[model samples]
Target: MTPKHVQINKQIKLHFALLFVSCILATYLSGPSLSSMPLLQWLLTGLFFAGISVLPLLFFIPTVMAPNARNLSWLGFFLLAYLVWGVVKIFSPNGLIGGLLVCTFILTTFFYTVIWLRPLKKAAKARQQLEQD
Candidate 1:
């Protein structure tokens, strides 16, 4: 890869990390954290909600930390559930803001992930053609 590609990859990874953090924040926002609850209850509720939503994504930590085309593609596919959840939950009476935020974060992550993978995919295809030739 050229220096330009290396630099772009670093930037893409940084943006993707930021998107992931924002998505997690959206999830936490969806829970009862904003309600007028006591300190302990609020803490537990926030933690449980965040934990359940984030636990599955934790499996992709390796992929996020060191991205490759295949793993990044898989991660994109995995995020579809979050996307759908956001869209569906938007209609709920109490979750409007949180749902909108979730939709925003998930869509940003998905599209950015695709952008990040495009160059890597082209490079992989080039290598495959070289091997065949």
Candidate 2:
């Protein structure tokens, strides 16, 4: 693979790992504070959020290290949604840990957005070159 390809893969890997860690942290730290809910209910809610967290990985894993622009674009949208969600939840009474988790989520989303932009630009340039040819 090209260095660009390798770099994108590394970025994706880091972003994915960080996102997963943040999800787990959010689950463990904030899930129990569901306003006097039963323990089982809290656990179930956490597990459900955890499942949602891994949903994007379902797309990335199958794409291998060289996802096309369109696939990455879709993932971009997914991360954007997560970033917005984090921002909206930043003020919730979930404690410092939860706040930090949301910060991590926002950071990872921003990082991935940068990483994905490079390839998208390259793709656009390549298409332009083709059109010129």
Candidate 3:
């Protein structure tokens, strides 16, 4: 496999690992109290959904969309928005450890966004320029 493929695989593994660890940690931290059960359940469910939802978008969407600069730009915008949301949650009074997790999430998302989008953007721009020529 090419280096790009290898990198993508590595990223996928990392994302899964992070998601798993985060969910486990969240559950553990929530404690055994009845009051915490609802919160833990909600958190685990959210994490599960997020992990499942993002995989298809990240790995499959480009296959149909003709990966281009515009698509990448949109992805970047989404990443930025996701990061912002994490930051906002982190700053909220209820977020404590949640804030730290958000920060980590932001960092990971930012890294993957830049890595994946840069090549797509470059290739798209090149394609556009070629068509215009």
Q: In terms of lDDT, which candidate is strongest?
A: 1
Structural RMSD, model 2: 3.7
Across residues 1-133, which tens digit of lDDT does each residue of candidate 3 receive? 4689457546744653563455345333332444645886866765665565345335534521343445555655665665565566556565556546745754674576467666666878999999999
In candidate 3, the residue pairs with backbone N, CA or C atoms under 3 Å apart (3 or more residues apart, or in different chains) clash, namely none
Ranking by lDDT: 1, 2, 3
- As a TM-score, model 2 comes out at 0.67
Error of 3 at 87 (Å): 1.7
Q: What residue runs in model 3 are displaced by over 4 Å at the alpha carbon?
A: 23-79
lDDT of each: 0.72, 0.68, 0.54
> What's the TM-score of each model vs. the native?
0.73, 0.67, 0.52
**lDDT at residue 39 of model 3 (Cα atoms):** 80
Q: Report the poorest 10 consecutive residues by lDDT, candidate 1.
A: 26-35
Best by TM-score: 1
